[model samples]
Target: MLNYKQKKNQPLKGNRFLISVTVLGSSGPIRFVVNEEDLVGAVIQTVLKSYAREGRFPALGSNLNDFLLYCPISETEALSPWDNIGSVGVRNFMLCRKPQTETAIDVEKSPSVSRKATGSWKTWFNNALTLKISSH
Candidate 1:
């Protein structure tokens, strides 16, 4: 029988990988490219830099503390609100990683005015109906 650790360390041939990244702050997934041998740190840097180039900055936990990277092979599995990753890999493979979440996102929300005093009816609209009369 194959040992668990032995089986886990099995070598892999040159294979293209499926890289999926989930950015915490932005609330979504991310993408990356690597030859597998590259350290997980490199990929994370690549992701963080990509967003930084766009003028958005998020905290990479690994930078400040021992943030462990966990790569879930199955996307269907449920993850918590704070389960970020910085896992490792070897050989040729695809990577599914999360982008660094932007702490301050520029949300494009239009200025909303309070219509609380619009009588008993819902009459909060931009264009108002007008009635015209010819005083002949």
Candidate 2:
């Protein structure tokens, strides 16, 4: 506990933090800024909604629980899809930066080379079953 003299000199404390993020998106890189104290779900939802306007972002967490998250800056310098605000020390931070990617386009437009559309496990399993049956 602080006396009147000490308390007056100390600044007030509350939820305040800054964090940056990097995401790998289909359309390339994107960035965002958010409060550190925000909920993990809110942060991820914001990032996905801001950058992935055309697709769905699967809940990123432990055992698909939808609560796990990451920090922006650390001594090790690692990045996660779900980063927390307090993890970094700042009031605002970049929340997304999807590295641009290069994919080769074939003039023939072969179906084999085309990227698979967004799908779930069941969809992938069904496709695998179809391919297996067709091959046999």
Candidate 3:
């Protein structure tokens, strides 16, 4: 990843690189040739425009700021708008809508029950076989 020092020395124009961006829930990753000096915000705008053309996203009325760009491998970190694309490295990244507070709560609750049920069945089956063998 390019750091602040490298970004400082880079020119704002004439440098372009291709990167893959996967829009969460979309068909697949889209390849974009972006200028090295382009801000993250501008890059997102370009992505949104392409999605709009493809009818993958709604009209421009939607707030672009509500979406975030994340490195898929390190999803917890979001790239800042002030940072240029080159600074983040030219690689595959993810675009997702920021989760709402209510939806976030629901997401946390649904998986544990399924896991518990699966474990419980395995434990019960093993105990039953153990008891049958002991009695025999």
Best by TM-score: 3
User: What's the lDDT for residue 107 in model 1?
Assistant: 31
Candidate 2 — which residues are off by over 4 angstroms? 1-19, 25-28, 54-69, 72-84, 90-136
Ranking by lDDT: 3, 2, 1
| Model 3 lDDT, full chain set | 0.67
TM-score of each: 0.35, 0.31, 0.60
State residue 7's C-alpha deviation in candidate 1, in Å. Answer: 30
lDDT of each candidate versus the true structure: 0.38, 0.42, 0.67
The digit string of per-residue lDDT tens for model 1 on 53-126 reads 65543544334122223344432332222322222332222222333342333233433432233221112111
Q: lDDT of candidate 2?
A: 0.42
Give the candidate number with the greatest lDDT.
Answer: 3
Give the per-residue lDDT of model 2 (tens digit) for 1-136: 1111123465644554444443422323335544454445556555555544645343222221232233423322333434444555543223322223334555256646655444432344478789989999
Root-mean-square deviation of Cα positions for candidate 3 versus the true structure, in angstroms = 13.1
- TM-score of decoy 2: 0.31
- What TM-score would you give candidate 3 relative to the actual structure? 0.60
Deviation in angstroms for 60 in model 1?
5.1
Worst 10 residues of 1 by lDDT: 118-127
